[model samples]
Target: MSGNARPSLTMKSRCLLTHRAMYGAEQLGSLPCVLHTIDMLIRDDVIWLFWFDHQGVIQSFGVKFVQHTPMFLLVLMALQRFNTANWGLPNGLPHGAPADEFVKLEELTAEHSTSDSQSSSISVNWSARTCRSLHFVGRCTQIFDALVRRRDAAVAKLSFPDVSRVSEAVIVQRAREVQTAKFDLQRHLPVLHFVADVRPQMSAIREFLNITTDACVARLTIWEKLTPIVHLRGADFRRCWFELIHAHHLLWNHGIRHLDPSAANMMVRYVGGASRCPQ
Candidate 1:
């Protein structure tokens, strides 16, 4: 919670706060140059949450926006909508709010599953309310907050029967390259990409979200050329392991404590052939 302890903001002020908070940070896109640029001017204490899209575009959302109305009013409208529809308030409405007022998106999970059938897609509830900022609370609690969204990248269920192209020498070389690349925020912890050419791709991905460090953290997920599965925890993975420990040290060095260091907060993704380090 903010220490200022001011009165509740007016509705209009809440709306501006919503936009200012939502648009505060630029989420990282897939481009390499974006990985290097960190824009701090746009970042502030108001942002509530961050979301990323399939193309690596990031969208930060405060409360939830419904046309021009602030989130609290929208909640009332949703309640009215549900009442008119004749749907009784379900069991899980927060504080027993009505269906329309607080629609039950789903039983919560690691990510929101869109439907029982869609395996590749996920969605999150986007609201523009005036409640206390969620991200701020998470930070106050010292939890390692993260915004994860799944992608349509290649997925494979079965292994290839043919062993025509297995080579230990190539894996060793790629692993070394992944372990040695120069990175800023997430150095040594595995999410490195080997982009032969990054300029054109950078421009294209910029539309999804501004590639600035202050907004979103970036990690390259590299797929094996022959197989869809990528490898992490390779022989050269010690660099990333040490990097994570060093980062933890620096955080404590600055007198900040991360109360939550669960596996979800410290994710490891594979690049080329090597594993990215844990958070």
Candidate 2:
């Protein structure tokens, strides 16, 4: 594949959704099985996950994918190789994706259809045996329909100008400045978190973020979610800075230098309680 041409798992029908109450708490921890399921949903541009009860009714569980830095894969690999011995899992890897976890990937299927403006009215068709299982446990039909409705709504509300000629640096710079805290308000929408129709200067760059939008969304708002007056000691900041430098160095080694390193780009979501490190 080209540098920008990513080879993604197009269709992952087998996705196991284990019942939390049925299985013991210990068996319920890691969820590697969800990766395949998440991959399928993301590939189809379905942004959220909706879980239902045994009665085939939708319940409260809903999940949205978060995007990470461009070098997230490299950072994940390094963290796994260096810190997995001390930490439970690498930072960027899915919460439940581990061999020792013994999580089983479940299969899901649903009925869906593709429509064109010039074609006849929307014709319904049952998805293949593979795609039907997702709709079974998750109410795939409802979820898929929700996606279409949201997409159309977005189209109707679209007012931004085309941005195909802008550089990644420019777009990144603009997105970082978006500091609004409202959940549904308009602001500088980070490319990592939300998808926009702006035209990209580089096709590969567009494809890069577009393809991985689901995974990197969290990193965009993590810092914002922390306490406004987070009380980090001088030493904690130093340690985080050190890790940031290390992450940047790794990227440099890969020939991808991030020209700008603003507060927005450096992520600080540690797993444990706040620590006091020696200055």
Candidate 3:
């Protein structure tokens, strides 16, 4: 497996990942998994689990493999030993995986009496299972798309390269800034809330064409939908502006000069009465 050669997952791999997740009888949308990369290395395959009864991800998990090294194996063994020594504690193992989590390692067995090439390669085929349930998870993406479309349409009506309340030049600048925001969104994948899980049988690494064979681990997180001020209107719009100004002065009074505020990073949340602002 080469480090830099990441072609999209093969058709077989895609077929194997049938449901992004399986919750009871519900199988969700096409390939709900995303990749975690580090220094151009493929790290973990992140997955989200949902219940139709819940608004967003009810739970999520990541699966990663560690292989081809004794040091790594020793570390895993130490943790396993620690877990074994501490089984009576109310909490699970100190260095063990999350509760309600399990990993089904591919071909967990004695090492093959063959060359490293033959022994180290592990093939994980997930799409082979027949799912008993199906569900869809775009309620959040739908809202995001709708707001973005409305924002784009509004921006599209702006008169650029012409004189207006603000200079035509400033309008051009604003348009470019919006484009930068679009590109920024395209280049980033962000999420929240983290609970880690290491597979119980996750040590084996199988051979795959153009894939990573490194020591890696998987952790889970909550996905969030962000609201940019450009997508906001009415009182919502005014509130963001208030926050921007309030935040600026809050910094200024603290002996700091807050300059270069951009709409790109300003995320909005609605609150009432005494509010707490988290930055």
Best candidate per TM-score, number?
A: 1
Ranking by lDDT: 1, 3, 2
Query: How does candidate 1 fare on TM-score?
Result: 0.23
Query: What TM-score would every model get versus the actual structure?
Result: 0.23, 0.22, 0.22
Cα displacement (angstroms), candidate 3, residue 10, comes to 20
In candidate 3, the residue pairs with backbone N, CA or C atoms under 3 Å apart (3 or more residues apart, or in different chains) clash, namely: 16-127, 25-133, 27-133, 27-134, 121-206, 121-207, 122-205, 122-206, 122-207
The ten-residue window of minimal lDDT in model 2 covers 214-223
lDDT of each: 0.30, 0.27, 0.29
Q: Candidate 2, residues 109-131: lDDT per residue as tens digits?
A: 11111222111221111111112
- 244-279 per-residue lDDT for model 3 (tens digits): 666555445544443556676565533453222222
Per-residue error for 130 in candidate 1, Å, reads 30
* Model 2: residue 46 alpha-carbon error in angstroms: 53
Q: lDDT by residue for model 1 over 1-279, one digit each (tens)?
A: 234342344576567656644443222111111222211112222323323222222333433223224654654575466441122111211222112221222322211122331222222122212122222111111111111233322211111111232222233234334422244443422222121111122222344444643222111112211211123345544565556666555555545344565433454545575555545
Among all windows of 10 consecutive residues in model 3, the one with the lowest summed lDDT is 153-162
State which candidate, 1 or 3, has the greater lDDT.
1
